[model samples]
Target: MQKTVLNEDHRRSGARMVDFGGWEMPLHYGSQIEEHHAVRRDAGMFDVSHMCVVDITGLDSAAFLRRLIANNIDRLQVAGKALYSAMLNEAGGVIDDLIVYYLDESNYRLVINAGTAAKDLRWMAGRLADWQLAATITQRREGAGALAMIAVQGPNARQKVWQALPDCRSACESLQPFFAARCGDLFIARTGYTGEDGYEITLPAEQASELWTALADTGVQPCGLGARDTLRLEAGMNLYGQDMDENISPLDAGLAWTVDLVAPRDFVGKAALVTRPQQQQFLGLLLKDRGVLRAHQKVVTSQGAGEITSGSFSPTMQQSIALARLPLAAAIGDTVEVAIRDKLLAARVVKPCFVRKGSILV
Candidate 1:
């Protein structure tokens, strides 16, 4: 397995290493539940260097991105603004979900999933070649220009990050959500997957350890992938491969809101989406019976059968909750049966989001 820059540090801190997308990353330092609670109640950090960061530039950069992403890039009129979008295939299948930071008309930054980084790069290259665009793609994952990313999240995340890096406070203190600011060599974005207020800091690879140490010294707990998964699940965020993939349409994956179909602008999969109507309604399910919901579990609804896309024991809710792709006829208030083991368990349909900013929505 490939090791990130913090692999040694994670080992030193007694992190239980696990293979995630070919990279040996920490599953947890000690108690996974405790780490999950720490993020919900206090400040916690994660090493996200395994994810890929690509910089797009050149004269046709804006045009290339407008045609590339499902979300309209024209909304990013101001610098430092970021947009959450899905890059879809010609068939409207979701290629990947990413956060694009708009720096200027000629430059933008994309943070993509680690598991699909290689494939995403190849796909983007192919599209560029076909379009003959003048945009240049530069990946900041390795070599001299390598960058290490750290996500500081939770309610007190910003304050702790400010305490650790005092110089960045003034610039990023007023930074709104879904925005980014470049402070010296640091590219700080006010974006997080854990449904909380925080910043995703990207800095030179060599300076990563020092920064992590500083943040840890400031009482920021180091979290791992185990906590990361539960947090994102509770926040109603999608996992690239589990929740949706190349064969899954964004419309069916609860990501239709991210697609800009209203705009006149054309995109890769706009035609397909226009021709085909919504097939399923993506929603949340809360287990009423004492059982845990898992992915691929069959959901028996009034209209027809569906399946759980992402399910787990929500730390904040203390119940088994899931995100499922159900039939359009399934209403939010309806009760459904899920096949757990040998018996069918009861689950209530609700909004996909169960938790946000420490508030229990469900």
Candidate 2:
């Protein structure tokens, strides 16, 4: 399995390591609940270096991206503006969801899910070739302007970040949400997956360890994938392989907002999405009984049955929560039963649940 620059740091901190998408990463340091609270109250750091960062630069970069992603890249006009999009196959199924950073008219940076790196590259390369566009994938080598991504997330996340790196204040203080700035050798983006106000800083790998140590000194807890998963799930964010995959369309994944079927431009999956009928719909499930929800659990609704795509014990809500693909007839405030171990438990179907900054949004 591959290791990141923080492999030793994670090991030293006594983190429980697990194989995530072929990368040996920290699952948790000790108590996942504690880590979850740390992010809600104070600040927490996550090593997101496992994610793939691809750079697209050419005279046709804008046109290439418009054709590549389902969302319209034209929405991203200002420098450092970021747009979240889903890359789709020709069948209108999702390939992966990614954040595209509009660095300039000729250059754009994309951060994609770790599990889809190779396939995403191959797919993009093939698409670029057909468009006669020049494309290159930036590799994170031992010595280069590589990005060692650290996501500092929480309600107080931005405050802690400014305190840790004073030099970044000038550029980041007035930055709008979902915007990024190039701070010397570091690029600080006001973005994160944990549904908090924070920065995902990408800097030289060699210089990252010291910055991480500094963040730690400032009482920013070192969170692992365990907490990260729960946080994102609480935020109603979709996990690539679980919530949506190559077999699912973004429209059915509750991510139709990310798809741009209009705007007079053709994307890879536009044709199929327009012509197809959406069968399943994504939703949030809150367990009304004392039980835990897990992936692949059968969701029984009065309309029919669906399946739990991603489910977990929500630390913040102190209840079991889940994201499931249910029938469109299933409405909010409906009562549903999820199949647990040997028994069925009742759950409430609500709008996609979110717990941000220590408060649950119901």
Could you give candidate 2's per-residue lDDT for residues 209-314 as a string of tens digits? 8888889888899999999999999999999999999989899999999988768999998999999967888999999999889989999999999999999998
Q: Residue 122 error for model 1, in Å?
A: 0.7
Model 2 is weakest, by summed lDDT over 10 consecutive residues, at 134-143
Question: Clashes in model 1: which pairs?
Answer: none
TM-score of each: 0.99, 0.97
lDDT (10s digit) by residue, model 1, range 1-362:
98889888899999999999899999999989999998999989999999999999999999999999999999999999999999999999999999999999999999999989999999999999999999999999988799999999999999999999999999899999999998999999999989888999999999999999999999999999999999999999999998899888899999998999999999999999999979999999999999899999999998999999999999899999999999999998899999998999999999999999999998
- Every candidate's lDDT: 0.94, 0.89
Clashing pairs in 2: none
Count of clashing residue pairs in every prediction: 0, 0
Candidate 1's C-alpha runs over 4 A off are: none
Error of 1 at 30 (Å): 0.5
Clashes of 2: 0
